[model samples]
Target: MSDNVTFDAIVLKELNKPLELVKGIQFPDLKKGQVLVKIYYAGLCHSQVMEARGHRGQDPYLPHMLGHEGTGEVVAVGEGVTKVAPGDHVIMTWIKGSGHEAGGCCYAGPSGETINSGGVTTFGEYAVASENRLVKKPEGIPFDLGVLLGCALPTGAGIVLNDIKPEKGATLAVVGLGGIGISALLAATTFDPERLIAVDIEQSKLDLAKEFGATHTFHAAHDDWEAEILALTDGKGVDHAVEATGLAEMIERAFNVIRPGGGELVFASHPKAGDVIRLDPFELIKGKQIRGSWGGSSKPDRDFEILADLFRQGRLPLRQLLSDTYTLETINEALEDLENRKIIRALIKISEPPADAA
Candidate 1:
């Protein structure tokens, strides 16, 4: 093993600030039941941007590393470990402290202690993971794909497939067609829907949504969205609406466009802290549901492999969902693409050694 090896990592040096490349992080002495993973790929998710913008939290604490979607091989393990061994490829799912589930406020509450305790500190070269935290990467699945399964796909698909479970041939709508929204669209493809509508502020994303399985694509900023969605459903309203943008207004709109007894899935984390959304009680009384999905309510160890198999069989076309790729050093540019809606699915490429291992 290479002792005292150092590597560069993008870090959040201040709250509401830009990320900077830094070096010289000391590898922690592995404690019992912990494993050290040499990160090969890390996705720059919107949540990380929230953290950088001080939306996840405020300063002093703001300076900590901020990456949750991590995939790599275990290089070392501490005493009493058994889930995975050194050299085993794995995906890191974010669930801090302790929690039985990954998505939803209830599941997220228990994780507060963990996130508060230390897991928020992982956007570095080598990340410390619990034995159960790492899910084995499937054969032939690229590291980029592995990291996405940990959160993006599961969260997106999990919301529709796991949480909302829209009825077969039911009309559906998804707002904010970014990573999560795109995954939701892909997930919609598996289950035949009467109508699948994709909504985003950008026309480029709306265009991409069609490729992901959307039957109709519309700009959320346009005045005709509600009318258009209703018109598509024959004015009956959709059976389910998924809010993936994390904006309060969009979530409220999702509630409005769904029919009585329809389901709404909130998948995005809000851009600002303490942002409140207003809703009417009559809507809920009519059997309308508003729910938050965490990592798509994914049980990674069990569901990820199932999803991987689907990907391999061509049931889920993950390749089409990916629109851009970036190297670790060029992370900001990748994120800029995300901000500009130039790309729907973006993966940060970890410059790897030759395909044949040493």
Candidate 2:
């Protein structure tokens, strides 16, 4: 493929509006530290939904590409690129890794205007990504399943293994059983927690959480849901409470369910702008700590391999997290399913895999 090669992409032409499936977009010439990748599968995450709804802030980059988690094959590498070569299957992620970090790309739009894209954008048939944003996919892993390693797995599982580090036999609760929440719940099971409580408003999510090793499941809509968790923990509370729902009220509630002494709450959600989480200062005085997680503070170069190994061993129930799959043409429908909480995780098939490749 050449710099003038035309491809298709889903663009955010307007805020709080449906994405525009624009075709015949020209790929920009690869700059230093950039790699051209043929995107195969992309994961639909809440972050994209938030951005599309203008929940986080103003839209400085209208007509920008959206998506940070995906699986692709390196079609070309630019100058100074060494971490990966052409034909190397890779995981496209927003997080930085080992390689040269290049700036965003500019593509020729269908209407002769320029389309803005970040270092890593996967809701398209092809992407020009920073070298540091791509990690070589593990051998023999299904490309569709490998897409989670780009974001959900690293953030969710990384929180359990790297951030919270719950001790064996400890009690833990995961609020909001979304993709990230369930990933955390799955990771917690490896620690042999005495009780793993899954909390969610939807019963379907709660049922799925049980299949992911949740020892106890509670519907957050119930008036006594917190009480149920408290009772499970002998009225003290869990040692660690993970808040993955980007809602302010859920964040506060997650903080309230932590044990009085030396308890910790780690939130991975990106709440809407001006949505403040009000917590009692008194809780901090009692050694209750609350902190936001940035992709589970993960080092993808090291953690993605570990997660892949877990998946190979059949220890990580990743397939169960995949609720649905859609084509790039139906990207809006996929996003709607996600926003409506009708799926755990939706995979967008951007392009077909090569005949020789898996």
Candidate 3:
């Protein structure tokens, strides 16, 4: 296997600080079941913000690399790799897919120290990902939009399609209008939900949700927001409620507004380490089901194809969900926009896609 390639990357040297933009990071030799990729675009999710802020608890792996969703082209493959090949366009994701789940990679930092990374990290010009963490990018999909398929699309869309599987004409509400929540709204539209109500604090997000096919939109900041949702369902409450915000209050509110019997709640957010949610036992006893979603229990190998087909047919509206794009030099700005709720979804252009990628 050839070696001696170096690239620029963003490293989290400490908690609650701007990531260190280090150049000339040396790539270690390919380990078994690894694939080297030339990254094109990556998506910034709220989970990375929590990790950067030290909200996810102890940081045993300080000075590590970050980011989990990206679109790239395979540059090389390690031993025992069979799922993808050189020059193949792929989505790099944290969700393990069809191939081998290789261990994390170690990149040599400029100061001669080892920078630890997970099985997949994408905020860089190049990345080494486990074979199972990649799925082939379908023809005719833009690489930029393909980044969303890596995480938000699967997690949000999957929650409705795979986990909840709400019946046609069912009433549904999606709280939080970020990428994941908006993706859920898009997916819910396809189910022919009788009422797809969107809840968010931002009018901009609600407007965007309506454009993406929400039957109604409500501002969550309203004191009677929950009541309004219940009113929409004729005082019974929605048959399904999906909460994508990691906030405990929102999670509780989502659970409280579901119909008593056979109502389903799926919280897709990754809550902070010390955060706990409280639900009344009476509600549980009444068959008000509640559960957390792990990437919407997605099977990337199969689901990616379905989502890509939807995008191609213009049903998914993947492009409308993107709010802004920034290059690696302005990644901190991207993170701030995400934290401030200024953007629906932030895309980081780590490197230009190959000329023929389109």
> What TM-score does each of the candidates earn?
0.88, 0.98, 0.98
lDDT of 3: 0.90
- Per-residue accuracy of model 2 over 1-358 as CA lDDT, tens digit each: 5554599999999998989899999877789999999999999999999999999899897879999999988989899999999989999999888999898999988778989999999999899999999999986678899889999989999899999999999999999988899999999998999999999988999998898788888888875778788887788989999999889999999898899989899999988998898989998999999998999889889999898888888889798888888998898999899999999889998878766664
> Cα deviation of 62 in candidate 3 (Å)?
1.2
Off by over 4 Å in 2: 355-358
Question: Tens digits of per-residue lDDT for model 1 on 1-358?
Answer: 3364555556666675567656655455566667777777776667766666677555554335557776787889878777778888878777432322212110011112212213422355666666666777876677766777767888888887788777789888888887788888888878899889998898877877787678998887775798888887777788888888868877887778888765554555564777888899988898777777767778777788778988888877776666677766677777677666677666766656227531
TM-score head-to-head 1 vs 2, winner: 2
The C-alpha lDDT values of all candidates are: 0.70, 0.90, 0.90
Per-residue lDDT, model 3, residue 146, is 93
Q: Give me the overall lDDT of model 2.
A: 0.90
135: Cα error in model 3, Å: 0.7
Candidate 3, 1-358: lDDT as tens digits: 2354578989888999997788989888898999999999999999889988888998998789999999998989999999999989999998888889898999898878999999999999898999999999988888999999889999999999999999999999999989899999899999999999999999999999888889888898875778988888888999999999889989999998899989989989878899999889999999899999999889999999899898888899888888889988898898889999999889998877877775
Residue 240, candidate 1: Cα error in Å is 1.0
The predicted structure with the larger lDDT, 1 or 3, is 3
Determine which window of 10 residues in candidate 2 has minimal summed lDDT: 349-358
